[model samples]
Target: MSREHWEPVTVFTGGLKPLPPEGQMTGMYKVRRDTPVFCDIEGLRGDAQGDRRVHGGPDKAVHLYPADHYTRLAELMPMASNLLLPGVLGENLSVSGLVESDVCIGDVFALGDARLQVSQPRRPCWKISHRLGVDAASRLVADNGLTGWYFRVLHPGDIPPDGALELVERPSPGMTLARLWALEQSHRPSVEEVNTLAEAIGLATQWAQRLKNRADWLARNV
Candidate 1:
């Protein structure tokens, strides 16, 4: 079978800084870079996370937000269209062609010299709303299934600013990140489906635990 590939339009990285309104530190405002960056077990060398508890780690190393989602986001929030741009979503790699619907958990890819595995779909947070200046921005992304995904470094190496992200393997071909996100967000999810996803290979530990907990809750309450 032929593998899928995509070239990132831009690579971005940023340090944590105090954001307004609450002065909470954030690393969600990244700027484009023109040079290659090192990708290690933690993440891009210079990338910083305001809160490590939920943001950065081996299971959530690199973030890739599809460039195409910006257009729909702009339409959804015309007032903040100016803020809806590539790299603004705090993604490390801003690329088009591949979106959540096309990517599945356990899928591995080669970019530059690094090997990365799809860990999970990004869980939209209040930071997104704060970054975009739209109170509904986070919810909009979640509802529309536009939430980008994170990658866990399987083989660390330097990632260049320009190159195609080539698929190396797909272990769970039918479990796309979009489907997982939808199932997870559904108010009344199926116990069987939740249990299956909780054991999905390459899925982040935290997400799997959450799914398992949800399954248990459903078993008792539903």
Candidate 2:
């Protein structure tokens, strides 16, 4: 496989205000387009994460959703197709080419002048269903493993809306976002699987710890 592939960033979205009260999603719903956003170790300078507890931090400095997934989702859920537009799902960067299956944990990429590392697969929540007004939106994302991915800023810089995201490094013994999502959804993940993921080089610390805890629990139960 090619060591690196480039993708065009289709949109750059940021917002400080919360979503509509009726939706009950409550987080930067009004994502406006910006030419280029200043990325720091924390995140976008102007972007605000409505719920800091579950979203945003150094580990999840940026949220990236595949532009291709939107098209697939539109076909799957025609009723909520209108809500599948870029930034509607609260992603900071919407890009084409790199999808869950292609992106691996710990992979490093140069996005414009900014450098980033893939941290974890996005864990879809109730907010997604609420935002789309479809009760199964979250479940669908989980099942399909199209939940997007998070990035941790390695070298803070400015990223343009149409910037080219180029993979710079891909670590060995890596786990793809799609595989990680599948392991997470498994009713009973093998101890080896849990241990492997827990020790994955590029995985987010939180996810790694969670996998370790799950492994411990299974060891105890079995």
Candidate 3:
């Protein structure tokens, strides 16, 4: 298997106080994914936002920092147990050893008892600088694209520390994490334009469906 498709070895969670019940970690073990538990979709809360870090609800979300700067994030939190970068996302689960190319929108993460599907890549904002140190968040966004996502929980429950991690289902074509990132940036395209590009990229059917869903979402937001 490609390194991209490898199983997630380290799951981490981030906070001002990043360590958990005990110090059971390594470079392979970092925040969010590294932590014993994770949560999302509840609401935003953290030291950066001034709230204790906890798991579950819509407030919980996941974000990923990449391995390219292992030496740096490691140093920043040399005594920290893990590094939690800000504004990257409401990152409930911070993952390691996984690549963005390996995921897609609507792809489900099967933790056996439950699952989470990729929604979209995080959009950068000021909160990042607040959580991660001013310039650090900017750098993460520019360098790694933060390369993480929001996983809507299909089944909310305990994600056992000792268990299997599997990819239950791959999203349809054109919905890969990379493709969704590309499509999200395509705000100027017309329906015809999107269809043409979607077809050429084999995203026609999925893109059309996604577009409808996106339209509904945007309409409600407006």
Number of the top candidate by lDDT? Answer: 1
Q: Number of clashing pairs, model 1? A: 0
Question: What residue runs in model 1 are displaced by over 4 Å at the alpha carbon?
Answer: none
Candidate 1 worst ten-residue window by lDDT = 1-10
TM-score against truth, every candidate: 0.96, 0.92, 0.54
Stretches > 4 Å off in candidate 3: 1-9, 12-90, 139-144, 162-164, 186-222
Which of 1 and 2 is the better model by lDDT? 1
lDDT of 1 by residue, 1-222 (tens): 578788754789999988767989999879788888889989999999999998989999999999999999999999999888898888999888889989999999998889999999998999999888899989999999999999999999988987789998988878999889889779998999999888889999989999999999999996
Question: Could you tell which candidate, 2 or 3, scores higher by lDDT?
Answer: 2
Whole-model lDDT per candidate: 0.90, 0.82, 0.45
Task: Provide the lDDT at 89 for model 2.
Answer: 86
What lDDT score goes with residue 178 in model 2? 81
Score candidate 2 by lDDT. Answer: 0.82
Q: Highest TM-score: which candidate?
A: 1
